[model samples]
Target: MSGPGPARPRLLGCDFSSTPSRRKPIVLAWGRCEGNTVMLEALERFPTLSAWTGRLAQVPAWIGGFDFPFGLPREFVIAQGWPLDWAGCMATYTALGRAELRERFVAFCAARPVGGKFAHRAADRPAGSSPSMKWVNPPVAWMMHAGVPGLLAAGAWLPGQGGVVGAPRVALEAYPGLVARDLLGARSYKSDERAKQTPQRQAARVELLHRLGAGEGRLGLRLQAPDALGQVFVDDASGDALDAALCLMLAAWGEARAESEGPGFGLPARMDPLEGWIVGA
Candidate 1:
């Protein structure tokens, strides 16, 4: 409709599978929001960790709102003596393989029995979720570990990189659901049930489109389907289909927030990823 308005830079949301094994590899979904409606698109199906990284080399240069953490838990870093900063820690993660990484994280959690299992971000106290090495939901921390390097290698910039105000460059470190929970109130719109994919789920999905600010004349935009690109939106009959749709809700919510809020959707200098935040709070 609007042919890519200035207010809305491309928003990308991904639901990564922590254990990207062949039996259940990582799932990557990308999407964008136009006003109240979100255009859902599926990126790739990585059956292996190596193939996943290998394919990430193809992500286009757009302001991405990835569902991965770009930072590490301050507590975990100090306790494990892992590199404390992004650049250094990435190098460390890159050096270690899956077996060693898991073993090390297990030991770290083992040391702290009660709450030791969860590491603390620098902003755990007042704000919340200062990007810790999380391994759940999407195991975003590892996603960051595996994903960010590719973005860097791709020569894209971070969220706050390059003093550009509204540049169409890459800005990683976005949690899409960071906004959806607020609008939907934990309403499970997505499920793995074929029967559950009844009118109810379809309706819920439609409703989400509106809350995301999508409409014919809302954001001055249109979702064009490029014939050359296929399978960008996976309609898996399993729970995976719903999961892919959930990623769209995330993208729409994120786009809405970025349109309203400043600097897109980012935590204050005091948020903690472990405790998590209230989405649009």
Candidate 2:
């Protein structure tokens, strides 16, 4: 077909861990998009954030969907007297130790009402992601602390936040739960604990994979994985592989938006730069 169509850009979906170890490393799903199809090529694991950052810096070009909040709530920033802009805010936030960050967050929550303890960014509601300030439960606040600084260090361009001019790798804040909810619909599909990995969750994961391959959501991109890889996704009770695959699809969608809509990576034009919007939210 005319010497084959133009090659698709490499895509990455990260299922990040705030504290990665050999047993629960950050998982990266590598793939490429062809037209409306996103194909998974491989999954890579990094036991440390440094190793992951190094890998990101070496990739020649990619649009990665990273499963972590890229920015904190503007309210939180202002209240803490941190810098208002994305770059300064991230720099100031990352400079503090995890314990110091937790202490500040806990104090902030203690001052507020029980139900409204956490401040939220604009993207949280639409994306159905947890408040970026939460330190416990899912500990996404720690994830942001651990992840975004590395993205900056690696020189990846964050679309709405701050972009590095001429940067080859593009990083978007992605939440696989958004896509997973669309396919699974409040159904539980994964668990980190062995005791929680029930047959019901396993069946839910199978159904989610089936629906994703059939292109069942608003993104309208089908997923294609080798049989063995597909098996890996289904068999992993931790759901890290499946989450990474979902991120890949989101990254592909962001890439398509970049091509058609030009910069901002399909994020709202008026979105607060200090609180970056989740791509495809």
Candidate 3:
């Protein structure tokens, strides 16, 4: 990690995958923020959720912005008769096996009319994110099912959920797409297929890094990195590296907001813990 600065905790940004594997690992970008600069010091990948959680348990202090849904929509929870509070809802939601959960979610969606099959969290519309209840397409529901429990198990403080003041490691919800779109609009930046990973996408990544380094875009924090490291962000066709960097910058922005505005780290004061807010939304 980079050297500490401003007495603030180190920053982390994670791009998560449900059912993480060696082929599509969960990527974590970690660094430090100094003044207006967010320096990305390292990138790590974990092949499994357990490995990621175990690594998190060892960190002494950090403020992380993870690319996963922190909670389900309140409407869905209420309709399903789940607990209303965040902790209780998570407990009730996580108890079921994935198969059972999928079955129930599928049924719920099937019963709804077209264009409204999935219920949405308040943050979804604002962040332009997928509905947390959708099991297919992105499988973000499963990501939530797999990811949040690990944060809880690792004893990381979840803002607006159950975080205590001065908690060693604070975890917040973040969306890299928000930052990416803010800067690059709808330009494609990544592809999982080798054939589809064209030079244009690589160029998009390069342009993104350049702009981010130059402190252009919504987060208002510059990315500080060596030239070679900037190349590293572009060479990966999966776009995981650049996405992680975007998330890291968002973390820095959140820290700045917390320092200026009160606590809550750029999240809205009225955010619902049951349906967590996106960090920069």
Taking all chains together, the TM-score of candidate 3 against the true structure is 0.94
lDDT of each: 0.51, 0.91, 0.87
Off by over 4 Å in 1: 1-11, 18-60, 113-116, 122-138, 160-168, 191-206, 213-281
Which one is best on lDDT? 2
Error of 3 at 278 (Å): 0.2
Error of 1 at 59 (Å): 6.6
Rank by lDDT (best first): 2, 3, 1
lDDT of 3 by residue, 53-172 (tens): 998888878888888898998988988999899989998888988898888888888899998998899999989999998888778888989998998888888878874545878888
Candidate 2 structure quality by residue, lDDT tens digits, 62-179: 8999999999999999999999999999999988999899899989999999799999999999999999999988999999999998888898899767868558789999999999
Candidate closer to the true structure by lDDT (higher is better), 1 or 2: 2
What are the C-alpha RMSDs, in order, of all predicted structures?
Answer: 6.8, 2.1, 3.0
- TM per model? 0.60, 0.96, 0.94
- Residue 167 lDDT, candidate 3, scale 0-100: 80
Q: Which pairs of residues collide in candidate 3?
A: none
lDDT of 1 at 192: 49
